[model samples]
Target: MIKTLMGSIREYKRDSFLSPFFVMLEVVMEVLIPLLMAKIIDEGVVKQNMNYIMRMGVILIVLTLCALAFGIISSRFSASASAGFAKNIRKDMFSNIQKFSFSNIDKFSAASLVTRVSTDVVNVQIAYESIIRVAIRCPLLLIFSLVMAMSVNFQLSLIFMAAIPILGIGLFLIISRSQPIFQRVYKVYDRLNNVVRENIRGIRVVKSFVRSEEENRKFQEVSQEIYNDYTKAEKIMAINGPLMQFTVYTCTLLISWFSANLIVSNVMTTGELTSMITYLMQILTSLMILAQIFTMLTIAQASGDRIVEVLGEKSNLNSGTLSIETVPDGSIEFENVSFSYQEDSDKLSLRNINLMIHNGETIGIIGGTGSSKSTLVQLIPRLYDVTSGVLRVGGIDVREYDLSLLRNNVAMVLQKNELFSGTIKENLRWGDENASDSELERVCKLAQAHDFISALPDGYETVIEQGGSNVSGGQKQRLCIARALLKKPKILILDDSTSAVDTKTDAMLRQAFKEEIPDTTKLIIAQRISSVQDADRIIVLDAGGINSFGTHEELLGKSQIYREIVQSQTKGAKVDETE
Candidate 1:
């Protein structure tokens, strides 16, 4: 785990190394200052020598300034290294997430990933900074200060030996108790973020249902969980302060009592006792710093594991070495294809689907809920690879093509259409970044989106809110269709994309497809019977397999499922006409 995290410290290696080097110099200077004071007290004051006092005072001033400079440099370098390391880690995690296949993505929730990138990275960044500066400085200061005190008077140093064990054991117990609580706190944070995200995305449903108070209660529940866990952890860690203070004062009293007798007996100088006292504070303060670092480590250790889990995951789908750049045609074939979300599970989402689609053909797919109609179409673009058989697009296996090339050739407007926060032109340009003004207007017209857009105050340049919240549902769908059309893909799959548009507009969009792009194959997935009745061929899916594949009239005479669906719609239409 340490090696994996260290990999992201790529460009910050120099800053990381420099931070500790300067910290060492600062600690050395600090240790020397105490010794120099010992000199002025013993040599200058005791002997009443003005020249020696003046000279030693000058030396102490120079040493203090040097220590301050080293401290500043260490802080600057440490800050740069820690912040840069976090930036690099976030970039690497995001880049890796982009490479993850749908199967890999399923292993982690959206909220968890967001927490890892933002909160978890920040926790580790602080730990990293502490490791380079405080972690390095404290141990060295403790050891050096102990040696100086012992050299001054070994008997007085024994006081610290007793204090050390008590502080160490107290700190150990505190950290051990708080470790698990800190781990649980971060996990709860993920849940809290997830709750907030869901509430925001479904705010409309929540308001329409008058569930704002319910949502507020849920948010408070998750928020309270986090608060309770943090309070528990802090309660355990709170022992550190009083424990350190008790130990420090106890050690100080013992040192003072022992040395006072020695001073009266003329065995130890007052100057030496003062220096030993300074060294005692240095030693105990270092121990306190070490305790703080351990507390941070407990939190960071859990966060580090979460980060490593994402970085270590390998995407299940691999783009093969031999890249097929050009898609010869829009032809798609599914030969004995079977898919399941889980490989070992007996249940399959799609099964034994043997079908062929020629270039420029318009195919309609209809199925009941959970019939895997969307699953079938997703496999064509290798969104999720088939578990058992071959799925070929453009006469080549999708895995063999460059992932970018294959996706570019096969454009999919999914069931849930998403439009980003940008001007209408900008969102449309996602399909073709270099598309011109005329090309943008033409595709929007084809999707029957131009009229509504033109009615808006800004027309094509209208700024869309995030998720296109400013636009109506039908307008959002048409804009998504226009965006997909901008791709000019050899194959276009509209998975219930026209469900929001009126029947007339839907028909006009289909007619525009036939007239404008004759050579491009179109796959329409819809619920309405009228939607698929005019297709070149219609596929009826049932229980994860193809029940029939034929023209509308052929299916009406042959397939039971297709016939029932048509009759049901016809009866509903008749009832509406009579009313």
Candidate 2:
């Protein structure tokens, strides 16, 4: 985990190194002040010498200023290094996510990734800043102060030995017990974020169903779980404060009592006693700071592990070394192919699928809910690789082609259409970034989208809300179809994309496809029989296998499923006409 995280500190190594160097200088200067003060009290004030007092006091002022300067420099560098490190990690995680296949994404929830990128990174950043700045200073302060105290008077220094061990044991116990609780709290945070995201995204449905009270109760349950975990961990950690105070005061009293007796017997001087007390404060204060650092590190450890998990995951799909670039035609063939999301699962999502499609042929696919229509098309783009047999595109194995070239040639508008927050032109440009204005209008007209788009106040330049919430469902589908058409791909797969448009509009879109792009292979998945009745070929799927494959009329006459669907739809249309 540590090695994986440290790789992101690519350019910040200099800043990370300089922070501790300045901190060390500041700590050394602070340790010198008390010794110089002891001299001013003993030699100058006792002998009543004005010159000696002025010289030592001037030196003290200069040393104090130097320490302050060093402290400011240390703080600046540490903060810069930590912030830059965090930025790089976020960039790396997002880049990695872009490479993830559908199976890879299935292993983690969207909410968990959001939490890891935002909240978990912040926790680790705070811990890193403290490690670079205070971590370096505290140990140096403690060691230097201890040495100076022993030189001033050895017997008095022994008092700290007893106090140090007791405080160390107390801190160790507190941290060990609280570490597990802190780990549990971050997991609960994932659940809390998931709940909030689901409620916000589905708020319209929630309001329609009058389930606001149920959402609130679910959110409160997760929120309260987080609160309970944090409260328990803090209660365990709270012991550090009182324990540190007791040790500081107890050591101060013992040192004061021992030194006062030594002074009366003429074994120690008053100046040395004053310096010893100052050193005592420095040592105990360092211990207290160390305890706080340990607490922060424990919490950051859990967050660090979560972040490393994302950075370390390797994508399951890889582009093979053979770099066949251009697809010759839209022909596709699946030979005895089978796939399962999980290797150990009992049933495959697609089983023994074998089919061949010629270039520029129009195919229609119909199936029940679990018939794997979407899953079959996804394999063409290598969205998920097949588990068992060979799948070929343009007479070559898809795995042998460059991933980008293969996907660019095969454009897919999935069952759920997504539009980002931008102007309509920007959303459409995702298909071809360098497409001209004329090209944009051309595709929109073919998809039956140009009419509505031109009717809008700003036409192609109109701003769209996130997820295209401002447009009706049918409009959203038409815009998505236009975007895919802009690609001019060799094969265009529409997965129930025309479900929202009316029957007349749907028929017009299909007619437009036939006239505008005769050389492109088109595959349409639909529930309506009329939608597929005119295709060159139709495929009916059942229970993860092909039920039948033939031309529309051949299937209507011979296939039981096709005959039943046509009769039902034709009967329903006639009754509506009679009424």
Candidate 3:
């Protein structure tokens, strides 16, 4: 985990190294100040010599200013290094997520990934900043102060040695008890974020059903879980403050009592005693800082593990070594192909699917809810690798083609027609970044979208809200179809994309496909028989296998399932016409 995280500190290595170096310099200045003060009290003030006192005072001011300068420089470098480290971490995680196949993505939830990228990274950053600066300074300060104290009076310094174990043991107990609680807290945070995301996305449904009170209750439940956890962890960690204070006060009183006796007995000088007290404060303050650092590390250790999990995940799908690039035609063949979302599971989403689709053929796929229509098409673009057997696109194995090259030749417009927040022109350009205005207009016209687009005030330049919420459902589907058409792919798969449009508009879209793009292999998945009745052939799937495959008329005569669907729809259409 440490090695994986450290790789993100690529360009900031210099700043990371310099921060500790400057911190060392700052500590050196601080350690020397107490010694010089001892000299002023003993050699100058005791003898009533103003010149000596003034000389030592000037040196003290110079050391103080140098320490302040080093501190500022260290802080600046550490901040740069930590923030840069965080940026690289987020970038690396997001880039890796984009490469994940469907199965790999199924391993993590959307909310969990969001937490790992955002809140978890922030915790690790805080710990990193402390590691480079405070972690360096605290130990150095503790050791230097201990040595100086012993040099002044050895017996008095032993008091600090005894107090060290008390503080160490206390801190150890607090950290050990609270670390597990922090781990659980962050997991709950994922749930809290998930709740918020679902609430916002389905706000319309929530309001229509009058379930706002229910959502609020759910939010309060998750929020209270986080609050209760933090409260418990804090209660355990709260022991550190009182424990530190007790140790410091006990050591101080012991040192003062011993120093008083030694002074009266003429065993220690007043200057040495004063310097010893200063060193005591420095020593205790370092321990307090050490305690804080340990606490931070405990919290960060859990977050660091979560981040490393994402960075370490390798995508399951990879391009083959064959270096195949160009797809020869729209022809696709699936030979004994079977797939399961879970690798080792007996249940298959698609079972022994064998089919041949020639170039320029139009195929219609209709099935009940769980018949794996979308899953079959997703394999063509290698979105998910088949669990068994060979699936070929354009007479070449999908894995043999470069992932980018294969996906570029196959366009899929899914059931959920998504539109990003941008001008319509910008979203369409996703299909072909360098598409000309004429090319854009032509594709929109073919998809029956040009009329509506031109009717708007902004025409193609109109801004689409996120998820295209501002437009009607049919409009969003048409825009998505236009974008996919701009790809000009050899194979186009529409997974129930035309459900929102009326029968007349749907007919127009199918007609446009028949006339304008004759050579493109088209696969239409729809529930409406009217949508696919005129296709070259249609597929009916049942229970993870093809129940029937033939032209529309052939299926109506030979297949019972096809006859039932057609008769039911015909009756509904007649009733609507009479009404």
lDDT of 1 by residue, 266-314 (tens): 9999899999999999999999889889999999998998999999999
Q: What pairs collide in candidate 3?
A: none
lDDT of 3 by residue, 142-162 (tens): 999999999889999999999
Identify the runs in model 2 with alpha carbons over 4 angstroms from their true place: none
The local distance difference test score of each candidate is 0.93, 0.92, 0.93
Q: Pick the candidate with the highest TM-score.
A: 3
Q: What TM-score, computed on C-alpha atoms, does each candidate reach?
A: 0.97, 0.97, 0.98
- Write down the RMSD of all candidates, one decimal each: 1.5, 1.6, 1.2
Clashes of each: 0, 0, 0
TM-score of 3: 0.98
